[model samples]
Target: MTDTSKNETNATGAPVTDEAPNTASADVEALQARVAQLEKEVAEYKDQWLRAVADYKNVKRRTDQERADLIRGASAGLILKLLPVVDDLERAMNSVTPEVYASQWYSGFKLIPQKLQTVLDSEGVTPIAAVGADFDPNFHEAVIYEAAGEGQGGKVVAELQKGYMQRERVLRPAMVKVGQE
Candidate 1:
């Protein structure tokens, strides 16, 4: 005769008891907790990745701006070297006799300074007007101080060498003669 008080045997042949239900519920609660934790971690990782992408974009923009600024100022040195040649050409043109000035060769020679000036203009180089303007130490370098004539006190009487500005910045100061009171 079979004993009725014996525990029930499952398909696996293991004796099942009331403790099986409690253990299965505990496992389900633990799995839910683990899923929540994994979700939280994934959110944090996503936020960090987004921040990294933003930082990279900012750095790239800054680098591009710096490169453009560098390119704009790169021609400054060469232009500085060419300034003396321009000065010489202007002096020669100014000293020309009336007979020589009327010659055909003088007309062709005059084009050289015009071309150089065009190049300077395209590069944003502009000559500073010093003569007759009030002398400022920033844009004018005083080479001589002479007695003021009429209303010329504290003004630039003459510019020995022309000053130039590249863009908004002074590339070279004018060598000038100032009028003194």
Candidate 2:
């Protein structure tokens, strides 16, 4: 008669097969979910790194522009303050008559101012035109108003103090008398 026991050995001495363990499928699914989550995290970190690099480049560019502007303004400020002294020297040169022009002292005085102006010109300091030109509030400051004759309104009558510019920026505004209709 055959044995009634469920556990039996085959001819090769291996145990008889039964259903697979219930936890096997569940463990495989959990591993796949973990892998997906790790991939998403890696993508987020990559995006953050790209943004940080872009921000650093932008900040560097802005700082460079500001520094260049500061250097330009420093030079312009020094030149603007020296313009009045230059104008006075010019007036003094003009006042010297033909007799005075022949004197050694007058010649030295004139040469000094001319040489100084040449140096200033090399550094990008330049004068603004004020006489007989149309009034521009950006470059001129009206110190006095005068009654304009025919065809003279809105014109610069006289310059009290000369203005100057460095490159494209106005370093000093010209002090002037304006004519009005």
Candidate 3:
């Protein structure tokens, strides 16, 4: 006897229907869409992580720079306080008479200033060239405006006090006598 049902039998006598294949294809399509959505979310999360890492590196670099700047400022302050002592030593050495200059004590005393100057030089402290240069308020403080001499108009004729620089920054401005027309 022949079966009258729409279902057909496979080799193992199991009933097969066209609707079964369509249902399985629909499930596969849903699963593929879910996978695509997950991939997009993962990409977004990865981009956020990279940006966070870059921000952390920038903050570290800025903090390190600030620390170095603070150290330089503190050292500059200490050097400012020592400049007067250097001037005093220079004055004392200059006033010594020939007789006193020839003494053993005078020679030893002169070495003190030389040693102090060496230390300052090693720390990047340098004297500003004020004499014979054009008068500028940034590096020279005009203590007296003197009458111009030959070819000395608007120039620094003499430095009453020495000026110093720490690296590129001005530690002190020179006290100068400026010549005017």
Candidate 4:
């Protein structure tokens, strides 16, 4: 065999090898391909991670909104039950004589329901209109129907029981009497 070290140099004056050069080039190409593939995989994994994080944030926001809504509804129900007591106090205060208004007990009773109603109004609880308007099935329940004197049909003649709303949602339907033609 010829001396490989002596035959290694090519005509371009660059050092050349018999086996090591080709082997080294092939190994470098393989390493580059491997690096490209790993980069693509890393990018895919990063995209998946970003999507997962966004989904988790959306779920957390939805849960917080629902919890807040539940708390508001619970408070509204308690206030709704107290409205009848307020109405009774109003009646009592209206019917009280001048001598009774001068008494401490009568003044205390009058102030209590008014304060309660003021608090409820500040919290978005409101009474629905049910008297003399057209009866609506969505907000009013007609327990009694009667024929009016003239030109009255599908109109609410009387409200037997009051209704209430909280933030555009009906908390209770009005019990009413409707006039029919």
Residue 154 error for model 3, in Å?
A: 1.8
Runs off by more than 4 Å, candidate 1: 1-25, 149-151
Q: Which stretches of model 3 miss by more than 4 angstroms?
A: 1-23
**lDDT ranking, high to low:** 1, 3, 4, 2
Q: 2 or 4: which has the higher lDDT?
A: 4
Query: Model 3: which residue pairs collide?
Result: none
True-structure lDDT of candidate 3: 0.91
**Per-prediction CA RMSD (Å):** 3.4, 4.9, 3.3, 3.8
Which 10-residue window of candidate 2 scores lowest in summed lDDT? 15-24
How far out, in Å, is residue 152 in model 1? 3.8
lDDT of 1 by residue, 12-114 (tens): 9987776788999999999999999999999999999999999999999999999988887778888888999988998998999999999999999899999
- Per-residue accuracy of model 2 over 51-134 as CA lDDT, tens digit each: 999999999999999999888878777776777788888788778789989888886777788898898889887888998999
- Model 4, 1-181: lDDT tens digits are 7777855667788667677778999999999999999999999999999999999999999999999999987887787788787667767776989898899888677778778778878878788899888889999999999998576699999988788888788878899999989
Model 1 C-alpha RMSD to native: 3.4
Top model number, TM-score: 3
lDDT of 2: 0.84
TM-score of each candidate structure, all chains considered together: 0.79, 0.74, 0.83, 0.82
Which candidate would rank higher by TM-score, 1 or 4? 4
The list of candidate 4 runs beyond 4 A from truth reads 6-16, 97-105
